[model samples]
Target chain A: MASNKEDVKLLGMVESPFVSRVDIALKLKGVEYKYEVENLQNKSEFLLKYNPVYKKVPVLVHNGKPISESLVILEYIDETWKQNPILPSDPYKRALARFWSKFIDDKIINAARKALYTHDEKEREKGVEEIEEALHLFENELKGKFFGGDEIGIVDITAVLIAYWLPIIQEAFGAKLFTSDKFPKLYNWSQDFNNHPIVKETLPPRETLMAYYKGHYERHVASNK
Target chain B: MASNKEDVKLLGMVESPFVSRVDIALKLKGVEYKYEVENLQNKSEFLLKYNPVYKKVPVLVHNGKPISESLVILEYIDETWKQNPILPSDPYKRALARFWSKFIDDKIINAARKALYTHDEKEREKGVEEIEEALHLFENELKGKFFGGDEIGIVDITAVLIAYWLPIIQEAFGAKLFTSDKFPKLYNWSQDFNNHPIVKETLPPRETLMAYYKGHYERHVASNK
Candidate 1:
């Protein structure tokens, strides 16, 4: 028998919230994995073969089976190694965390993107409605504390997506979607989340992310004038 | 001594996938609870208090702590009681299942609903593209006869939102988003899933669902015409 541990490989792009979520989860869990930076524009064959359906990154290859999607990978990482527990132990509490996480997963990016990126007045108006609606719900979910009831948990992971990605959108749209004064609870939540030690150390530098998204916005979105 | 059993109550709507996922998980795990049908139109004080943010259904009230969101609830159910294990033990495998489940949670309904409900040619076309794109990813993810690989797992529970809801959509749109000829794998997945005794029994009656949706769709979407 070989006395070697199998390597954990992560196929990810730096700019993606989906990919970054996985990275944060891995760090939170304290797992070491090899990283392959995937260019989404010109996807690698291995990526295509591994995740042919989505053609997206943040695929975790363990042993041989390839796992796609960030949250999926997060669960896998949390379970495989028992380090930092990302989810709460109580059933009802865990469920509450997952519910909002899923809500954030569904609403945070896709719903906001079209509106923020659109040149059309109608689409942009719809985007604004969606953004405002999302912020309203987000403010409500914050509950004047963390998403996991006065502690950081899965909803915290998801809330970070908006905190991290919204700046990019704020720049792209030339408007402020998340105002600290307007949604004070949510504002505090973002500040508290970013202040967490594990998160503080691992997060992608803000300036780097800003530079990356600036280029990404101008080139990819054809009608975003 | 007073009753030791917790005050376990589930706030749900009849035709809600979010509600149904938690119900099925609770039932499968042999957990007992009270069911309250929430009138989403007129928000209840309890719902507002329990799920203050979304004020949505499927808020599992256990010992008085309320949990919202279906996926989160499922994980909570799996962790708290530890019966049938809706999520697997291995982290990597569980994450993979969740990733696919989240993808479904995020994309599936929008894709199908847009195709079935929207009247605008461009909107409908965009919906079609989203549905087809989502399907390609699903097809890749669904390698096992079941989404859980052997038994129905959390991904299956999450995917059930599609399995149950699509049939209703299919009824409304006879053009059929998921015929045997089109989404063969999902078609089979849906059949196998719905046929399972636990699932088959758990679902709402088809005729009632169709009628309810007919009115819901017509009244809500003025653009549907």
Candidate 2:
């Protein structure tokens, strides 16, 4: 049945939260596609040709056309596959979903990276504060079990990074940045997000992710020192 | 007749390219709404309450519910009104439109700012190179009269800043960063974009914008010196 779908191809890396977004969305939608993992240092010509602008992964090449940017790709997936809707049907609801998704991408993600990767104490503290503020804002928006009531929607897909990557990054740095006690609603959401059937199936092994990020972070810290 | 639509309120400023995006979209959609020009230095309580995360302008309050982020608001307006479709109907085309919009916002705008605003010659040169590279990519994407083929779509809305604001900023800073000879396609697009009836009406007066930006840039430069 899935073979009838379009020739969908994803150029992605397993450890990337952005890539995971496309992975989970495709899985949830029951879309069949070929996935090629790209090395950052030695990027494939396919990836380069597909996403010449950014040359970044999670590029969804549908048939001949390539769509870069995970958020954009998610929208493309939802629009193309009508089975399991990743976005809400209503306009207003969808707006709020997009708003929060962009918020997570623009504010929360960058701040989390700084908190985890910055070498200086003051800079790290600032980054931590910004993350806490962003997460606090997100915490208030978690009125229902999931970001969009019961359904795991657009915002959830965007926030998947916080669900999966945050733990590994925090553990790698030995920082309790995003604990259950700090942001209970988000913490709970992350737990629920990771346990989602499609998400669970698609996620990279935790130990592998931890080792990869740990080595990367240590190298980054060492170079700065 | 236009007065009886929805209770729409735009919390924005004249100078902001992002604000201009929402303005142009609303005008094109023929959606009448109240415009409250916020003094960005002293933000309003209403603005703060609505968009606590960014606390920035271009917040569209429709029927009391507020939506922030210019790109997100553009999508909301299109979906709700459905009168003049700002985005393409085809999923692939829509994805491409969105991809370009994201690129313009993330790459073009920032580089333009740095190219014009930075006092250092080397940094300014770097910014200019990045902006030129981005604009060159955009020039190639201009395959039709408009990005939406014939109708001005989401990419056009997102690119409105580059069309109008870029010239103003360049002239204000005494910089000839973007020129007709250099970027014939983008230059021509800007001309068409500015001449569009809805765009012509919505654009801030060139002299007023130049004066405002001139003072602002001078102060910024003086402070850095």
Candidate 3:
């Protein structure tokens, strides 16, 4: 399976949760790729051409073909390279993993994105309720160690990004929603996922992330105010 | 394979777009499932039991283990049944299908739902731009007849639901969006999909769906205003 392929490049920013999702996926599969950081405020021409639709970061380039969505890129990474496979071999199990991943992607994580900067009372509350309700289900349904039962897989990756990033966002915004006591299972799982060697090495330092987010939150607040 | 393996029941509503994605997948696969309509506004015990998290529609109950999320249900359908396969066996092809499916799911179709009901002009434009951008990609990327290439498949199901549903939604709100000239590929594809014998037989009539959405839209606007 080892072969020299086309030049692989990644268009992303350091602080993007969305970009981080793709970064983690690529690292997990041990696929070699060039990382080209994109400025979200002023996107590069290549980033714009590669991903004109959303114009978001974490756009992966493989043999000159660009796949923008993180989840999509994850699947492509797994498919194109056989080493360090991401998806399970069993079809049903794969489906289950994908389901939980989609659940996290579509609802819990996306819902939390809105809650981060929402200053309006009703909007913030709506976002909080959405997160709380979602976490309640996440805590209850995932009785096992990981979303993939005993194994740490793609769903685990999706959930982990939220867990780690959520706290940073919360701290930046002064909104403490994900308490250890409130979501014990999720809390522990987050710790476990972060502790993994691959995850440990790949993640940007918390202090760095926090510092970046501090400026981000201040800008957001000032603009809104 | 179709011996006596319990009943396959789908809890969904005609008005719900997420449920519609699952329905199209099921229909395309030719998998027989008992459709149990659930009104989300008036939450049902069954709905809660089947999907406690979102409590939304498009929950597929297979031997009592309920799987929610339309994309998740679509994957589950493809995995469980070998009849008419929705996903391709080739990994790269499968990834392409998933990429486009997730792309459309995240941006175009799902975003449109919020746009239809929002009174805010900015929010409305956000939704419209999302749909427009997605359609542009769809028209450009889909060089063949279907998003699935020659025949109908996952991307077809995803595209069909969004394109056709737009008109129904427009009818409901006394507006228009799905113009023929604007999105030639997606618009024409919607027609082909809707006109197919299988799709024609299964899909709800446009007039029926239009009438259903009209009342639904009016009530929300009146109350919200």
Candidate 4:
């Protein structure tokens, strides 16, 4: 458990799924910390100083040392706090968790981003195909209730984008990429994940997310036109 | 130390820098393992079974369980072997190492690949600019003799591409993108990294890599035309 003496601060934006990941991890570990929301357009000097390389949010500053990258921060939080272990104990299982977490980020998220945002019809179609294929793999891999096998682990944490943000973004764009019919298992898993106690509290309200993503989608469409 | 009872096997292709990272980590840990070279053009069923998601090389199979992704494999090896510690002990330091390793993969490698292989002059120039900016960040980060300070660690292991393959790739393409003058610290570090005993053993022969890359570059150019 994190001690009261420890000074932990998270620089993030309310709407970022990445920031939500850190928040959920800290909450799972029963650790309390300061959440300083950053305006993405004009990032603060502190955020830049902390994460000079990427200058992005979800930077976890513990005792004045900054750890950037949400996935990296999740691991750090797990290691530092030790309770409600986010990753598995066995080396092979831990490797599996890391592999799935990375797949979500590299394959699913990237393809979903393209599918939701791209103006080109052909490119958007390709992106949708790629994301479905990637999601199908996840659907096949889900032998248990959740990706974490009855518990919310790193894979489930990293897949927050797929569970929460993807649906909202698709709604905002008036697109149907991830359907319950096509991916029933993944759809169910997302439902369970969203309803998880910690995740429920950590996630932004649906209406708020819808409003934000709608504005973003409209701006993207306007700019393209 | 890995015992003789441990059944370890590595499925890899000779020329891949990603494969070399696993090889170097295995050597550094003094872990005895069988190395099976895979013909990437006609990938074996074994490779497909082990890494169905990516169907890529550098899959580490330990006692029947398989681990894919070079960075994921490196961490698995470090945890399993518990010798020649590839990653730092402290949580914060480990996070930093993960951060930089990811930067090398996501920014530097992606940009370098585009710069080296892109058919369009504008895209190639853009790639060169992106790679240079990314490398400048690395150059600034290199405060010691090595990224790991005194010993070779995961960051240095992941950076094998920049040390060995990049120079050969540039020469094969008849492009001089990574000049020593522009990044003296990174250049010196690369030289040191290349000369390290484990890395020296793990890297493919210079002529062999040059021959392979030259063939690849020619094929790419011919196909683009």
lDDT of each: 0.76, 0.90, 0.77, 0.91
Docking class of 4: high
Q: Calculate each model's fnat, 2 decimals.
A: 1.00, 1.00, 0.66, 1.00
Per-residue lDDT for A19-79 in model 3, tens only? Answer: 7777887787777778898787788999889887778888988878778777777777777
Q: A142 in model 3: Cα distance from truth in Å? A: 3.7
Model 1 misplacement above 4 A: A1-4, A110-115, A120-157, A162-165, A168-173, A179-201, A216-225, B1-4, B122-145, B183-189, B216-225
Q: What TM-score would chain B of candidate 2 score versus the native chain B?
A: 0.96
Question: Model 3 Cα displacement at A216 (Å)?
Answer: 1.5
Give the local distance difference test score of model 4: 0.91
How does model 3 fare in lDDT? 0.77
DockQ of candidate model 1:
0.60
**C-alpha TM-score for every candidate:** 0.82, 0.97, 0.90, 0.97
Ten-residue stretch with the least lDDT total in model 1 chain A: A1-10
lDDT of 1 by residue, B93-207 (tens): 6666677777776688778778767778799888988887787668666888888887888888887767887767566656466667778898889889988888888888888
Interface DockQ of candidate 2: 0.94
Clashing residue pairs found in predicted model 1: A72-B95, A76-B91, A76-B92, A95-B72, A95-B73, A98-B72, A99-B69
Mind sharing the TM-score for model 1?
A: 0.82
Lowest summed lDDT window (length 10), candidate 2 chain A: A1-10
Candidate 2: where is the Cα deviation over 4 Å?
A: A1-5, B1-5
Q: Answer with 2 or 4, whichever has the higher DockQ.
A: 4
* Top-DockQ structure, candidate number: 4
